[model samples]
Target: MKYLLQGFTMGLAYVAPIGLQNLFVINTALVQKRSRAVITAMIVIFFDITLALACFLGVGAIMEKSKILELGILLVGSIIVIYIGYGLIRSKGVMEKTADVNIPLKKVITTACVVTWFNPQAIIDGSMMLGAFRASLLPEEGVNFIIGVMSASATWFLGLTLFLSIFKSKFTDNILTWINRVCGVVIVLYGIKLLYSFIEIVKGY
Candidate 1:
């Protein structure tokens, strides 16, 4: 019980940050159909679970020891994130009233995967925080902790989607456009921050 609570609290804290993954999910929910948004949410949750498990199972140790790997990930991930943010900022308007902006399922899934997996912050959170937490638990307690983390992730995504679905009608088209612009700016800033961090790491070597 204690381990479960600890894991849940930590997971929520990590996931609650407004990063690329969360922004992607929220944008999907706001622009796409409810069904499509749900699918995207599921993909995000799937990756979250996979990452948490990998970290808890010692992938974090490998990542920590490999500066080259970390640098490569940060470089590519920052570029991808920044590119996506630029696209968002360049878009003319929101598709809130129409399905014109609805992209194919494959593209949605692919983007979600990229945003979730290639996010440097997400990688660090899963590897450092989750791994460190797992290291503190007994073998038997590990499963409970994992379950708690997964539960928190599932709850957060679902709640986010649900909230968006309910309030989506309240947002005007201009408001939606502004929201997109704001999210894009934030994402781009995060990408730039990741790039700067990567450069700092490289300089140390």
Candidate 2:
């Protein structure tokens, strides 16, 4: 029970912070159907949970075995995150259009997948850090820990979506631009952390 609380707290600390994914979901809620954003959240949650499970199942051994692979992934993920952050920082428009719109389900799914999968830190965070954390708990506590992480994920996604949906009308190009900038900055920090970790891993190798 204590471990479960710890896991839940750690999960919230890891995920509750605003990032690219959060901004994307918020934007989706403002422009597209709210369900679209919820779907995106579900996709991300599933990916995260899947990776966490892998880490819990000793996938960290593989990650630890190949320092070169870790370095490569870290470097690549850092670069991509930095680029995305730059784009977000310079973004001028993020508001919903006044025009009637129809967003295709395929595009929604594709966008969600690309955004979620392209993030290298997402894999490391889910499959390694959180997963490893889960591994440290007693065997009986493992399931509770997983449930805790999942709960945090669910709480954040649903909370974000619902909050944005309610006040979606308040979003303007300027407001969204600021939100993007903030999220961009946070993401860039994550990127920098990834790069630093990569360098450390490479040095150890």
Candidate 3:
């Protein structure tokens, strides 16, 4: 229980920031039907949990041993992330009776995967934070601790979905469009940062 609570709190802190994952979830909830938004959140939660597990389980170590592999991932992920941001920036943000023009499921899944697993910030931060915590845990406590973390991810995403749905009416097309543009800018900046990191790594070798 102690480990669980600790993980829960840590997890909340880890994911609470207004990054790609949160922005994606928020936009979906704000623009889509409740059922579709819920589904989107569920997909995001699955990827978030898996990504957290990968980070906590020494995937970062494997990448660290191969600079080429790490650089390749960062480069590819950055391009994709930047492209996603461009799409968001171009989106019309039409919400209301016509809000049913939903994104395809496959696209949603792909976007969620990219924003969670392929996101450089999520990768670097999760690896540093959760990986360090993993190193300090007793073998027996690992499961509970991670479960707690996963629980936090679920709660936060689902809660955000619920909250936005409740107040979704408050958002106008203009407001949603502005939100999209802002989030797009942030995501593009993240991609640019990752690209810059890739160049920095190249400089070292």
Candidate 4:
């Protein structure tokens, strides 16, 4: 129970941030049908689970022990994040009439995977935060902790998609455009922060 609570809290806190993952999910919910949005959420959840497990196992150790590898990951992730953000910022305004445009499942899954996996910030968070916590736990406790984290991810994505689906009609096209702009700016700022952090880390070496 204690481990469960700890994992749930930590996982919720980590996932609650308004990052690229959330933004991508939100956009999908807005544009796609409920079924499609749910599919995207599931893919995101899968990545979350996979990453959480990876960190809990031993991948985090590998990352921590290799400064060059960590730096490389950070650099690549930051650049990709910046590029995605730039594209979002420059995208045309969302049109309600086009909201139902049929996007292929392959494209949706691919995009979700890229966004979830390619983001360095997400990798760092899982590895550093969850990894440290997992290291301090008993093996059984670690299992419970991971379960708690997975539950959080599942709950968050499902709830977010449902909420967006329910209130989607209330939001005007202009409102969605503003949302896109705001989310884009936030992502860009986050990318810049990641880059800056990388530079600082490099300076120490």
**The CA-based lDDT of model 1 is what?**
0.67
Q: What tens digits encode model 4's per-residue C-alpha lDDT throughout 1-205?
A: 9889767755765574556677778778887889988998998899878877886676545655776766765666566656656766665544334332256888777777777888887786566555545434567887898899899899989988898899987746566456556656665665576577678777887
Compute each candidate's TM-score over C-alphas.
Answer: 0.61, 0.58, 0.63, 0.63
Off by over 4 Å in 1: 59-101, 169-205
lDDT of 3 by residue, 1-205 (tens): 9889867866765565456787788788877888999999999999999989988777445554665656666676567657766766786565444333268999999989988988886787676556545544565676788899999999999997898899876756677576567757665665676577667767877
Q: What is candidate 4's TM-score against the reference?
A: 0.63
RMSD of each: 8.7, 6.7, 8.8, 7.7
lDDT per model vs. reference: 0.67, 0.62, 0.74, 0.70
lDDT for each residue of candidate 2 in 62-160, tens digit (9 for 90 to 100) = 545665554555576567756666776776654434422245667655665655667777665555554344323445676787778777777777777
By lDDT, the better pick of 3 and 4 is 3
Backbone collision tally, model 4? 0
At residue 92, what lDDT does model 3 achieve? 57
Candidate 2 stretches greater than 4 Å from native: 58-102, 169-205
lDDT for each residue of candidate 1 in 41-150, tens digit (9 for 90 to 100)? 89888988777787667743554566565566567656765765676576544433332326787887777777878877667646644554443345678778888888
How many collisions per candidate? 0, 0, 0, 0
Instruction: Assess the local accuracy of residue 103 in candidate 3 as a C-alpha lDDT between 0 and 100.
Output: 83
